[model samples]
Target: MQAFAYVACAHKKTNLTNLLISFKDVSIRHFNTLVFEDLNFSLEKGQHWALVGNSGSGKSTFLDFIMGKASMARGEAYYPYFDQHIQEHHQDDPLFNRYKLITQVSARHEFRNLSNTSDFYYQQRFNSCDSEDADTVSTYLSSIKVVNPSGLWTIQKATEWLKLTYLLDKELIKLSNGETKRLMLAAALIKNPVLLLLDNPLNGLDVSARQDFNELIREISESGISIIMATPATEIPESITHVAVLESGKMIIQCKKYEFKPISFHTIGQIQTNQDELKQLLSATPSVVYDTIIGMEDVSIKYGDKQILDGVNWQVRQGQRWALTGHNGAGKSTLLSLINGDNPQAFANKIILFDQPKGSGESIWEIKKKIGYVSPEFFQYFPTGSTCLQVIESGFDDTLGLFRVSGKSRAETSLRWMTLLHISEFAGALIRNVPVSIQRICMLARAMVKNPSLLILDEPCLGLDVERQEQFKNLIDTICSMTDLSLIYVSHYQEEMPLSITHSLKLEQGRVV
Candidate 1:
């Protein structure tokens, strides 16, 4: 990978008139499942194209093919140097060598050893794995060469351009999602690939980050580099000159961005929860005055020289639902950890969960029994091969897998929740084999199966498409209206918040803002 980046940095300006990338009757497949077939497309030197699609519509697969990381089943896919550059040379002494693909999944977390294997492609997908050895921001930036030959671009200039100076000394893993993306974009720019591919570049980013990224994209386009990006229709920037929409193994529509008006995106049907039963399961006695669900006073967390949370004060009562708002790296995850009793730091802080002070001799399991949690990370690490029913049934014991035998009543409860989530058909299917969207729904069912007093959802809508996000939000609304389930919903997109969120907590740089 470093060799590829180095080659790109060393290449001279190519003829702008030549085709940069071409796909002629190309078909791509993964796990023998066809992604897209009979796709014919061509990218010019300066035109920017948006590959528009919903989740599972093969947007990422499209980009992976361009990166040479994905296999073509039947047709032809060609790159400049690898195809035309070599063919023009009579298949000898190939001159082209660089292709930069900045995917939705970060390449930062993968072991350097897997650099030669295709398995390294999506190693960072759907989860954030912390790396203590990640290089500091400045060091990371300096490693890449500035592609511009006039010595006009420098590491310092790139840092300023991306608004990443604030994280100059922070480890890559320590940066927030927004910060990480800015750095990734900068890395791509430094390599100066003739053809650049971005997969959902705006995802998990705050509004400011998106603005910064769009500006960067414009700058790259103005510099005459070819760009192919994959994003949903709603997020297609005005900079896109052309748009292509993909459906079941085909390009249903391809036209100029200005002329493309996507029909309203509405999924097949919505998932309806059992409101009456949810209400019963969520029933709780009205606390007499001081009963608290979660309380934290002057809670601070620091990892060596880094501060994660600084004197944060917050409280959750019996019936209140809260929207936790913050940019990436705002300590939202840390705060949720305190409530979920998963962090050892909770023992040193004056935090209370379920009316019991943390570290006051309350068993972790006991505290966990009263609070149900779901997060993207939870789904990523969820045990594989466990059937969807087993995943939900295990919620009864607060375990990773179904270890303890569930009673008939518990089994029935799991089945009911699965039905409400519209994943009953997959009840016997392995959770790993289920589609990502369905897997997330099953996780939600697991969180609701035990009917805990408090619900903590940390960006529960992270991977869901628009329709799935709406369905999840509607379920949350139903639970809030019918039950006394206290909720701490965390999300970067304000629009994804449910109507049940009556209160909000904002965090900025590890402090309550």
Candidate 2:
């Protein structure tokens, strides 16, 4: 196991009166792994910090240390501010002390149904009947017990700040990836904690939402709430006063925000793909060539009185790569569901997929077999019990998890995809035990293992670092160059789009703009 360290920079003149937390020669371990050693850090009351590192570099683990979740092996972690606050106000109430000081909004959230049970699958989001079992955004938010409401963040204020006012009545499972991110932020703010921890907070957000969130973070910091956020170096917000860099579970450098320079540990070299393996995978599932991969005429999707997609007209021809751009709740997911045959409403609409008309004799599995797909929702709800190899193998059958024993050839192909994605080491690891970024890479491998004719990547790079994002983009370009694969790529950042995208479609309020 690799050891990790964190480098924190602070001014020489430290005021004890304003000191929030301090760690002295802190050694920590998680399970049997030594994550950090001799970690010395301090956070003042007014400073906001950003932890910048690659995947599995202990950024999230460091956040856990601050939340008193890490198993400390040596030294002392003193929380002066928290201690004083608790002693001054609620010394007798242990529960209040445990719940009032800090809150964390992780990169991945586990949402429950209205029955308060997590008995749901990945496809439940697309099924209208199953989706209704989830609590509404309003209900979810209202159910959180506020430990200490300082009049800083009310439910209304938090929703308005996160731009979640329109999604109050929407079911939690039905919200878009970006929408769910906002709801999570809102729920955190409602707790009114003195210290807030955000792990990759801007990952799933759209461009506008990210900008709004940065400003909101600034507001929250100004209102006396200190924040420690884990994010990419390029995404460190203006609100952050200091920055800490961690690599290989060790802190290499720390400096003021203005003094910090972003570092790229992984070089963007040419990715060498095994031509014979690629040929074998591509030829394994030969697809029928069609002039129009997808054709939609006056397509409209409605649920009850609300309109999701309104008279949308779009066409995707074979081998054409498309960039699908839209803000949060702009119906981008809904549009993709129609093409992927997940939504039953497609039967009522004049939609054509893979040269076949809707309501044809073709089954949904047949349609899914020809189209490789990956999205944030899929990653969030994916079964974590299976090993990464099993998850990748499941792609061949277009199922959520591996249902039957995979053949030797299928397992070999899956390992090849995992190796190509640089996640071969985790092939034997269960999805639940790895970091979120590793799990995301596994999902990407699953989408490509089948070598389908059409590929739909919905914010595929959501939780990846700068290095992984570049690598995946390069892989996408390489695959398109080698095969006749059509692509419908959705991303908020223009730079994140693959160079293969030659056409674009933008949506606003469910209408093509």
lDDT of 1 by residue, 1-513 (tens): 001000111112234357676778988875456777889877766678898765567776677677766688888766664355445533553433444222223322222211233221111321233334456777776776544444333566667887878788876545555666677876666665556677777766776777777777777777666678877677787778888776655766666676766554334555556777666555523423337998999999887777889999998898899998887778887778777766677888999887778888998788888878887545544667799899989887778789986689888878877776767898888876555567777778788777778888877776577777888899888878776779998877888899999998999988999
User: Each model's RMSD to truth, in Å?
Assistant: 8.1, 2.9
In candidate 2, which residue ranges exceed 4 Å CA deviation?
1-13, 263-277
User: Given candidate 2, what's the lDDT at residue 321?
Assistant: 97
Worst 10 residues of 2 by lDDT: 1-10
Q: Give Cα-based local distance difference scores for all models.
A: 0.70, 0.83
C-alpha displacement of 395 in model 1, angstroms? 4.9
lDDT of 2 at 71: 84
Instruction: Please list the residue runs of candidate 1 whose C-alpha ends up more than 4 Å from where it truly belongs after superposition.
Output: 1-17, 80-134, 139-154, 262-290, 377-416, 424-436
What is the TM-score (0 to 1) of candidate 1?
Answer: 0.79
- In model 1, the clashing pairs are none
